[model samples]
Target: MIAEATEMLLSHLVLFVLVLTRLSTLLMAMPAVGVGVPKRVRALLAITLSVLLLPTISNDLTSSTLPQIDNLIELLVAVAREALVGMLIGTVVQLLITGMQLAGELISSTGGMQLGDALDPTTRANMPALARMIGMLVTTVFIGLGGHRYMLAALMDSFQTMAPGNVILHQGMMDLVLHELSVGMSAGIRLAAPVLTALLLTNLVTGFISRTLPGLNVLAIGLNINAMAMLAVTAMAIGGASWIFSAELDVVFERIARLW
Candidate 1:
């Protein structure tokens, strides 16, 4: 009877570990729940959530049904797989901001602001102020869209539809993720398009001013106009694009779970 009881305990352990791994992975990588928060806090949150979820999950679906040693190995693999998926999702979200950052850099370069650089508090990386602005703006919209809640819902549903023990990720999932990458890059370029267009126009107008009016300081005027134009465009875009962009934030996160 003692040996049987020990076996039952081991089975439950395996299942709990599998779910714990999934929860931990999501917490570690998902926005708001991931890096922005402290590690200890996140762990505590994961634990609370896991306990709440454990009762609802069946023994057959968890470590509770497995023998002790088998449960341990399965639990390890299950947690690691969940972590891999969480990391993948998290990386996609991070790249979206990086895309915006790159666009800002391009705009800066064109506006003759290539020498400028600064530290970004959120990313703890050296980034131009313009890039930081663009990245921060998008991140704000992501939060405003309730992206964190949506991510959790998607995660919970994913377990229901696809059990943790299966450990199977279809190839089509990569293709879908790639599609998100394309969408993110496209959005970044679109946000910076006006600035880029205005910059090009500035160069044209400045060249003509320099050629036609040699006495004027074309570079100085060009610098001021470039700065003013970028500011104006960003301000205008932010006003209208905030809602549209925020909607996409939810879509991007959902793609991970909903897509093939």
Candidate 2:
């Protein structure tokens, strides 16, 4: 009886580690949860999540051996596969967020704020002030709308459909990713179109005024006018931006679910 209990304990331990590997990888790339979170806190969250998910994962491990390898080579290969799957899941969500940031970049470039770009904490890269604000705004909305919960649920579902040790980079996944890239670009354009249009009109007006009054410094006035127009247009378009971002995020979950 003791030997049987020991064997069961070992099996659970192995399954727990494998589950933890995937969870940790996914959480590392997750927005809001991964980038700024402390290592210790992230580790605790991964462990806690692993334990909670163990019940669902246990059934899949029944046929596999505890070591599941004849040597270290096979073990490393398995680990790489698990990490790849986790990374792929994270990448899908990241692409949607990237689209929102791209819209901000467009707005900033139109408004002349791209020159005033600074390092953004969220992405740890130099980004325009407007772009940073938009990224943060979208991220806040995503978290507030239970995006994290949906991602967790999706991870669980992936295990049931894809199963541990069965993940692969197949053509279907590639097609989905390509489609999403197109969607992201479309979303960025839609979000920035209103502001861009306003800026274009402002430029035309400034050019006409320059032609009418050659003495006036169009360069000096055009920049400020463009900046103001950008602010006004962005404020008016913010509601639509939010709707677009939310809609894209919803699609992210849908595509991820079909990955299996």
Candidate 3:
């Protein structure tokens, strides 16, 4: 009886470690939860989530379902597989934010906002003010729209469908990632289109004015005009930007669901 109990405890412990590995990787890859969060806090959250998810995961981990991990090397391999699965899911969700940041970069360049670059805490790099603002706005909107919850739901679903240690690294997965990346790039361009158009027109008019009044300091004036135009157009198009981001997010989540 004691031997049986010992075996059971070991099995449960292994399961817990696997669960914790996946959750830790997921959180680390996640944008809002991972970036800027302290290690201690993230670790605590991972532990708590692993504990909460263990019971459900236990039901799915029968002898037939669980991978054979006879030794430490095999266990490590299983853990690595689980980590990959978690990273894939988190990366899929992160693509939306990446697209939005791309839009910000375009807008900032067009509007000459690159001079106002600031240190982005999340990325630990210098980014244009507009790019940072747009990134934060999209992140706020994502959280406000319950995107994090949907993300968690998808993670939970992955466990049931993909199952830990059962990850199949295939060409299809690579294709899916490439397709999502292209979609994100196109979405970013589309999001910046209105602002780009407005900025283009503003520059043209500024150029014409400079030609008409060569004595005027048109360089300085044109800069101010471009800034104002960008701000105005962005304000007018903020709603549409949010709508596009939300739609893209839905598409990303749907693709993630189909991965299993």
Candidate 4:
């Protein structure tokens, strides 16, 4: 009786560790959950989430159809596979979040502001101030809309669909990633289109004034006008930008589901 109980306990412990490998890897790759968060806190969160999800996935471990871990080598392989699956999903979500930063690049380009760089608190990376601000705004919207909740849900569902040690890598996965990246890039351009257009018009008017009044310091005047125009255009177009981000955030989870 004692031997049987010890065997069962070992099996459950092994299963829990396998599940944690994936969850911990995922938390390490995600933005708010990983980038800005302290390592200890992220680890605690991953462990907490793993415990919560263990019951739901426990049946998976007991299934006869599940892959057998015959030795230490097999267990290591399973751990690696699970980590890859989690990181893959996290990368896709990170790509979506970068759309806002791309839009900021577009807006800053016209103002000659993209050249100046600063440290971003969230990512701890150096980027233009406008890009940093937009990234923060998108992060705010992501949290506000419960995007993190949806992200966690999708991650949970992946285990049921993909299963640990069974993630298949195929051409379709690459195609999906490419398609999502294209969508993210297009979203950035669309979000910044209004501001870009306004900046273009501002440049043209400045050029016309410079030509008409050659004695004026056209360079100085144009710089001031571009700054003012960028501010105005940003204020006017923030609503549309938010809508684009929200729409893209919705699509990210759907794509993640299909990828697995």
Q: What is the C-alpha lDDT profile of model 1 across 43-125, one tens digit per residue? A: 89988988888777653364433323444565566667767665566666766666656677777777777667798765777
For each candidate in the order shown, give its overall lDDT on alpha carbons.
0.70, 0.80, 0.82, 0.79
Candidate 1's clash total is 7
Residue-level lDDT of model 2, residues 79-112, one tens digit each, is: 6877777876777777777777788899897788
Candidate 4 C-alpha lDDT tens digits along 159-250: 88776656666786677678778887888889889889988998999999989999999999998999999899888887776788889878
Clashing pairs in 1: 11-63, 11-64, 12-63, 12-64, 14-63, 15-62, 15-63
Task: Report the C-alpha displacement of residue 153, candidate 4, in angstroms.
Answer: 1.2
TM-score, one value per model: 0.85, 0.91, 0.93, 0.91
**Poorly placed runs, candidate 1 (over 4 Å):** 59-75, 121-124
Under the 3 Å rule for N, CA and C atoms, how many clashes does model 2 have? 0
lDDT order of candidates, best first?
A: 3, 2, 4, 1
Model 2: weakest 10-residue lDDT segment is 61-70
Model 2 misplaced regions, further than 4 Å: 1-7, 64-67
Q: What is the C-alpha lDDT profile of model 3 across 198-223, one tens digit per residue?
A: 99999999999999999999989999
TM-score of 4: 0.91
Could you tell me which 10 consecutive residues in candidate 4 have the lowest summed lDDT?
A: 60-69
C-alpha RMSD of each candidate structure in angstroms: 2.9, 2.1, 1.6, 2.1
* lDDT of candidate 1 at residue 128, scale 0 to 100: 79
Q: Which predicted model would earn the best lDDT?
A: 3
Q: State the weakest 10-residue window (summed lDDT) of model 3.
A: 163-172
